[model samples]
Target: MSLRNITEHTIALKDFQVQGDAIKTHPLSIGASTNRTVNGQQNPVIHIRPGETQLWRLANIGANIYYKLHLPGTRFHVIAQDGVPVGRAYAEDTLLIPAAARFDVLVQGGAPGTTRLETLPYNTGPAGNQFPRADLATVVTSGTPVTRAALPTDLGPYENLSHATIADRKIVVFTENKAGTIFYINGRTYDSSRTDFVSTLGTVEEWTVRNDSDEDHSFHLHTNHFQLMSTNGKAHDPTHGVYDTVNVPKRGAIVVRIHFRDFTGRTVYHCHILNHEDMGMMAVLDIVPPGARPRATHSG
Candidate 1:
């Protein structure tokens, strides 16, 4: 019961909206307004002071939707991810925010119930190709709204297992074929592997993602960032702190953990919506620095 690192007042998400998109029935907008903006907008509530430790700075200013923030019973710790700050941290019931990213969660607010902030669209596809994009729930109580009835069907529980010993791991494979695409992370579409993983510097990678098509694809990566020890298989308390876009909970299999030191060149980990990464999804990485093996670009 000794968790100190308290910093108060920090919860800002000004006007965000994104209501469901299949053909429109609940596709509110304004997660940053769109042009192609990758679906973003679910629940955005703020208010803390039950035990202190609230320091949030989330702003996906672009909207690509795929957040799974929680606080129901309270168990938070995700030091930093798109904002940097993690020497070796863990813990995540659900934390992923892509699209111009930005995260810094650490809620330890003691008992008081009500704490839900959901957003879905991991990689919507299958189910006959798509249709059923409707998930936007938000509740950060202090007064009203905290009556548990629905919103915890499953997919919640990864409090750190053992930091899956890593030497090197990367496999992000998400697909969505046809023509009118909307999601696809690893299947070679977005400008051809955008930058196709290339780490080395101080290597310490781990990304075992496989959302096999049928919707739910939020595999984001940019400038080598990781800290989501586990999900799907369970485990999230290695200090559940440090994240960068981890909402891959449908087919489920999220394992993020990196330490490539200060970025290198070409940094962009797509699938944040914007026309499904310009109609193909996206991928690109090159933090090279070990046994250099560059030169592997494809296009056919």
Candidate 2:
């Protein structure tokens, strides 16, 4: 029951169906929609003196959800995204966390008042699922005022792998045919015998992923992280940080650079949506060992 309640706060909530009247009859059998708290109980409160500093590490474990974490008055000095620590802190009030993404933020406990960690509803697209609004936890103060920690002035410089050095470029397409019943990647279903992408070990490549569907889908790669180069043709500064899974907006696109390192075997890239992945929306990536001959791929 606790597991189901927490998932409602994530993108995985899209799997639940609304039965009968949405207002009266419960949409979920686990009784999550009413009280966002765990098992309908009050959430544990974090104690901190006013103006005290805190380092928050957040991770999205949902199968397929996107949370735009908002702190309202509290500013988030993000130092890392995914597992890669940025060279410096990126300050913002709201951060977009896709499925399986991680973020490390530095926050200062501000004025003493009851405040909740809230997540607003995100519009995926015409075909995307509707996720409800909810609160994750409550923030409380110890009633004592304190000085804030000195913020880091500099971490280091963030550099993006240049396109000039890219040995190859791959395309990822999210397809949902109006007449088709299931999702697909690159116009094909997942088959272990088939390889969709192949690259030489220790080489970097560029990938342009497009969501041609009516809903949003998160593109997640296993065993590696990538740097975002541009979104819908706009250059995205690499200083923001690198990420593992990124949202492909409906009819939108992104270009990212990735490196194939160390281990060389078959891995995967797929939509973080559990149902979609289960229904054949995934592909295998083959990283050939250095000096080994590349295999003939089955994808265009």
Candidate 3:
């Protein structure tokens, strides 16, 4: 994987509308719509010159599906995970679309055959979850709805390359019981908790993501990227190497290394399922400047 010819592109969210009516019954679901454009459209398409090494900044805005971002006929050398650039390479097919997760995928464009950006359901399906009245349920215990299409892309500006060391890390614990199980980070629920992990800006931290749910959950962060250190207590693939969004299988843990840089505000980390997130599967991280008065940290 090389970066000699990678050009940047922006992925906007557009052509989207509220999905199901059944969504209304759910406490935190995105209510019904005739043709609602929820997240933005106009996702950036990366065009890599043949045999060129280019860098791309990939971002997501609220679309809650997992995207298998790839350049068919071409392979990408991962230069960065999330927002922090790395010195290694990793080949990937499915890029997790966790609200604000970012990745720097280096690729040389393929043979010009409609490179498809696919979004597949992380779990089994969304078919039976809908009530007769058309309200969308947060959990799809039955099957996937055929109407679902490609997930949206949310891209943002790239700040100066980020680099920091791990000051702290923790596992986002997601435990729930329902027709569709929701998630929680560190046993704290989303929206209700507001803040989950707090870090000092300019500091690096390693987060170990543990997924103890019956279904898969895509854990995403707001302002940073992480290196694929280990999964299930083993080292992640370093050749087809590194990624920003990772799919944590049921009953496993993926360890990620990240650095906090640039923006410092109330950033979010959550499950990409927009409904799940809105229903309480999300958390916030605060990036405070170093040597400043420290806030009380929580670990449970």
* Top-lDDT candidate index: 2
Candidate 1 C-alpha lDDT tens digits along 55-97: 5555565444444344456554555556665544445666555
Error of 2 at 9 (Å): 18
Better of 1 and 2 by TM-score: 2
Q: TM-scores for all candidates?
A: 0.31, 0.83, 0.57
Across 1-300, the per-residue lDDT of candidate 3 in tens digits comes to 322333464453222343364423334333223221213333333333333334556565544433444333555455566555554345666555444456666544433334444343334223212211111111111222122212112223332212434477676675555555444666667653345667777766778788777656677666666566777888754432345566666777887776675767668877765676665678877777777664554443
Distance (Å) between predicted and true CA of 136, model 1? 6.8
Scored by TM-score, the top model is: 2
Residue pairs clashing in model 2 are 11-65
Ranking by TM-score: 2, 3, 1
Task: At residue 187, give the lDDT of candidate 2.
Answer: 91
Model 2 root-mean-square deviation: 6.8
Candidate 2, lDDT over the whole model: 0.72
